[model samples]
Each structure stands twice: as C-alpha cells, then as structure tokens.
Target: MPDRLDPKRQFLADLFDAAVAAADPRRILQDVLPPPPKGRTVVIGAGKGAAQLAQALEALWPHPCEGAVVTRYGYAAPCRHIRVLEAAHPVPDAAGIEAARVLQSCVADLGPDDQVIALICGGGSSLLPAPPEGLTLEDLQELNSALLASGAPISVMNDIRKQFSTVNGGRLAALAHPAPVLSLIVSDVPGDDPGAVASGPTVPGRPAASAVLAEVTARGLELPPRAMAFLQAAAEQAPAAPPPSRSTTRIIASAALSLDAAAQRARARGVNAWVLSDAIEGEAQEVALVHAALARQAQHSGFPHPAPLVLLSGGETTVTLRHKGRGGRNSAFALSLALALEGQAGITALAADTDGIDGSEDNAGAFVDGASAAAMRAAGVDPRRLLQGNDAYAAFDAVDDLFHTGPTGTNVNDFRAILLGELPDG
Candidate 1:
C-alpha cells in the first residue's frame, strides 16, 4: 500500500481512474432515459454494473420504478427504490439462479404502458444464471468451470450459456411480451454485441446450437452430458418464435468510450495519445507481444506518433490457465510486455480491468517499466517461470506492481496504456 504512493505509479493509476469514471452508470444513465410512461416502470438487469445502474436510475428518474438487479458480490451500489441482490461471478450459484427467476418475474404481466429498463453489463452471464428445467445449479457450475478453463472468448462462452438457460437468450424479454423493454448495456466483449453481453437476457438472437457444439468440440471442453444433450436437442428442434419485438437495446458505456476518454485525458496533459484500438482481443501474452512491438516502434521511429506518446487500447483478453495459481489477463499481458521490452528505457505501461477485478484475482492488474525486470530479479522472482506457469500475478506482486482497487462498481473490460518517453538527442 505504501509504494502505491509513488508518483509514477500514481500517474498510471490516475489515467485508469479517469477511464473508469468516464463509464460510470450514473454519468451515462442521465440524459439518455426515455420519457416517463403512463404505467409502472419495471427495471431489471444482471451484471457487475447492474446494481450501480439501478442506483443511478433511481436517482435520475423522476417517477417511481420498482424491480430487482443482480451483481457480483461486493459490487452492489446503494439503491432505495430498486432491489440490489449480490451473487457469485465468473460462475453461477443458487443465489444467482433465484435472482434470475426474480428478474424474469419482474417483466411478467407488464403491459405496453409499463416499461422495463435492463441494466446489462459484463459478468452478468455468470451472475444471472438460470438453467433450463432438466439442469441443476450444480450442472451449471460444472459447465461454467469447463468453458472458463477452455480459453474461449467471452462471446463464444455466452453463446454456449444461452443454449441451456431458461432465463437467458432473450427468454426474459419474451416473458415481458407486451411491455416495452429498453436494455441499457455496458459492453465488455469485442464488437460490443448486445446479444452476447450478459448472455443477452433481454436482447434477442442466440447462436445456433450446432455452432456452439462445434466450438465446444474444437476447444475440447469437458461439458456435462446433460448439457450436451440439451444443446443437441435444441439444435434439432425448430427455431422458437421470435423474441419480443418491443424490446430495444442501447449501449450506454463501452470499451471504445473508455479508450476515447483516456486519450482525451492524455491530450489535455499535452501528451500525444493515440488509441490503437478499442476492440483488440486474443490470448493475453500474444497481445502483449503486439503492444510491446508498438511501444518499441514508437521508441525507435515514432511512426504514426512522436515521443511523449501514450498508446491506449480497450478490450478483454483471455488466459489459457496453465497453472492453478491466481492470475488474470491484464497482469499476464503486463508481465509478458516487461519480458519483451527487456528493461528498455523510455517506455512504461499499465494494464488493468476497469471493473477493478481481473479474472478471479483480487488485483485489477499491474504496471511495467524499464525497472520491472530488475525489480523482479532483485526480488528473486523468476519472470520466465512465472510467465510460463501463467502466474504473472506473482511476478507483479513480487515487484510491488500489483494494482489493487477493490471493486470499481462498473465494468468496461480492460484498459491498457503504454507511455513512450522522448528519446535523448545525439
């Protein structure tokens, strides 16, 4: 906690804070809400940001709207009118199952005069899980564990989830038939597909079961037999009726918006901020290599941008999970970049999840600079072994570079910034 006061580290932390603040549900909820309807407004959602969105909506809306929202435990925000329920994330639990049931009931019997505002965001898939009739909570827990370990992208995982969920895949919206559903989403997946965010409980469109099964086989995931049968049966069955046409969705906050905000912050400070992309996605270490190459290019040629440059990107990266120890994609990317840089001067980088949780780990992510290598070696940390074991958290923690901020209340996926210092003239 003491070294967290370091000015250089604080600068990076400040940038991350700016990015997160930009995506706050309270900030985005205002000025975007539709006019008050004549009947009741039923609010419901599931995600890491759902509770915060509910609290913000309650504060912003002039009329009374009642409903329930589920969020990852410890991520709940205070709300007087809306009910805030906490549950497990990255995996489903009984609490989440019950919450999903309650959320579905919120939309039931709602008329066209009533409205439903769904606060959807990252982590909702696991936090709002509700399995089909034949599936038990234990079964869902197993499916979640395998899919997470298989290293499939979030979109793919969500598609598989939709296949077995009685509450996901627009089923919830279908239940709310006559009501007008406005899904306000905070996207954490690449391409910002609402149908994938939180498994699209209110948004329509689910990938074909055959496609998801193919992915499972390709990824070699150990799926439950019951789950497999469910998918096969669903695939062979005729497509269900279309989802509620009255339901509409809007992305209130996303990685792109967060990246833009970070770039703007850099520009305000006179630094040349170039946003590389807001949709970069892949294996964490592999993406680090690309980022390291860009940092090196800016350091050498300054092509596309000059010195005093900060390259920013926003997206969710994956970890293959070779080792059992605690580590997340952001930390993995930072460690890999440090090794690739080999303590090269005039460059520093920070990688963190804006939600303040990276994977199942406690820390958000970490920072790397010219001193990272030496610091690790001085601390008797084997960067190569740790990286090989997918234990970047250990490397960063050894060097006191682990960035921890508890839960930031909202999520917009990962935020990475690489600062390229000006080269000394010959």
Candidate 2:
C-alpha cells in the first residue's frame, strides 16, 4: 500500500502510527508504576495490552515480579518473568477460562505485605473468560457470542460480563484483600469506566447487574438457559457487589491522548487537524454516516475547519450482526463511509483500531479514498450490497486497501481520520 501513489496516504499512515505510539504501554507504563513494595510483587492483567503492560512492569521494577497476563492471539509480548498466554478475543475460549482461573489463583495465598499490579485494556473482557460458579465456559461463550452479535455498546456489554465472571467485577481485586492492588488501565470504553475495561477485573463494574440483564434482554440477546438463569438469580439473590475502592486504579493510556497525538502530528505537517471527540460511540455504520456528512460539509462550506482539514476521532463502535459477516467494526464503518462519500474528490479517510485488530479480523481496518468507489466498481464489487450483508471486509479486500498492523500492543479504541484537501483549483 505504500506504493499506492496517493500523496496523502503516507501522511495518513504516519498519523495513525503516531496515535498508536502515544498509547503504547511500554512508554506510558514507564511513569505510572507504583514503587516496588518491600514484599512480593505480583503482576496480573488481561487485554490486548496486558502482555505489553506486564513486560514494561518487569522492566521497571526494582525487585522480582511474577504473575500472568492473557491477550488475544498474536498479541502477546515477550516477557522473562510474567507468563504471556494467548486466547481468542471478541469471544472467549477454554484457554482464557484456564487463564482466568490461574489469575484468580495467582492472587490467592498472598500476604498482606504483597502488592498486585494489574494491567488491563480493550479486548480484555473476552481475553479473561472466567465464568461464575454454576455457569460453564460454554455458557459464557454462548453469552459473549450473543452480545457481540447483538451490536450492543461496550458499556452495556461489560455490565453483563461483570455479572458472570469469577475474576471480573472487582472479584479479581477483591482477591488481593490486605494486599494493595495497583491497576494501570488503558481506556477503550468511553468515559474510561474501570469496571468495563476487561470487564473490570481489578475494578468493580457499574450499572448494577440487574440493570445489565435488563438491557441484554431488551436487546433480544439469547443467552444459554443456564447463563440466563445465573444472571437472573445473581441479580435477584445477590446485591450488586459494591464497587471496589480498594485498588489504586489509574488510566495511563486512552483514546483522547492518542487522538491528541495524531492531531499534533497533523498540525506539525502544516494541516489543520481537529479532534471531533474521543468519546464518540454508536453503531459503526451510523457513526460513519455522521462522519461522512461532516466531511462533506467541510468540503462544501468548511464550516468547522478549513480545507486541508483532518477530522480525527477515537472511540469504540458497535456492529450488530444481522447477516453474519467477517468484518469488524472498523471495516464496516469504512465501507459505509466510502459509499456515503460517493467518490467525492479531494477526500480520503482511514478507520482502524489502535490495538491493530479491528474485531476478530486480521486487518486493523481499511482505507477509503475518493477512488474507493471507483475501484470497487471496476472490480464488479457493490459496496452497498456487501454492506447490506455486513461483509465490509470483502468490499475493502476487493480493492486491496485493507490496512493490516498486527498486534500493536495497545488499545485506545477506534481511530478515524478524514482528510479533506482544498477543492481542486476551485
């Protein structure tokens, strides 16, 4: 793609790289680590950034460190002491089931003098799949698949996740009783809710379990009978585990910082870059329409920013699986944006997940420019039709424009950039 002959493509790619660098765990973890305790220090985490966060902690601590972290397959970072385990993401697997159990056991038998430093980020809820008692891993997997298919928002999804996890919803941190816990979270969910990131393994979840179950039922998600009963019983029988205040939770990386970094880079290159927001969320296709509309306005009227403007944003987007396609949220959004742009000239946009995988797909996302529509037409591919089937990956793949950056070791959520250049010689 580097030789695609688009003048703006390289710059856009650089902008994305800058954003990823800003949220890299290795750099952010350098300053936020709690001073090494005199006693044993245990490192634990689950997410796309878990391994990277653990590796950074191992590098900085003054004494010995031990524990484990679970990340999506192809996302593990090399570590000498901390165990890095790979697992399926956006859906849980037996490997994650075991890892979550190990995580719980890792914190067990700890003395009051011990310290636990947990690293968590996006994709964590799926990475650490520990089902509560009375529910099987199959039950949790079926529930997760339902949630992903339902296209529900992260906030709602996490609320339900915390209800069934043995280690999540503050249970993991609660294990560190007497032992102080320090959690360094890289925010992917909007508002940076600690309990939602990786299902809040170290932090308590919000929106009471009963409320989450209600939201899930409202969305028509079908949980396994046992899973459904467990959640219902949990809500009816047990009170919402009071949110945990015991852990020292700090957000060291987030979408806002990454967007700021990208915007700064754009400005350095002499372009007018504006960050729309770091908290944007909604259905991927719907959100793409809004962004496309904004880009068109910038092209016609330059209302918010001038020509040569780059509208940037970061946040998670949902994709409800009606037709059951392979594309992730970013690809779906890119395809929708491309169709809406309708081959408009002097405009190019990129949508990608900062963690380097947009859902379960190998490509982080895709790039759509003024030529995208034309290219698809030439290949006899109908972008709108593919989108109708929820097959965004196929649409983008036909054009050879899918952006692939494997396991970026970070998760600040989606990053989108709409670069609208000056109209040709007006």
Candidate lDDT (C-alpha), each: 0.86, 0.85
Number of the top lDDT candidate? 1
lDDT of 2 by residue, 281-341 (tens): 8999999999998888878997677778999998889998889777999999999999888
TM-score of each: 0.96, 0.95
Residue range 349-399, candidate 1, lDDT tens digits: 899999999888999999899779778989998888898898888999887
Q: Residue 339 lDDT in model 2?
A: 87
| Candidate 1 Cα errors over 4 Å, as ranges | 1-4, 422-426
RMSD (CA, angstroms), candidate 2: 2.3
Q: After superposition, how far is residue 244 of candidate 2 from its true place, in Å?
A: 7.4
Scored by TM-score, the top model is 1
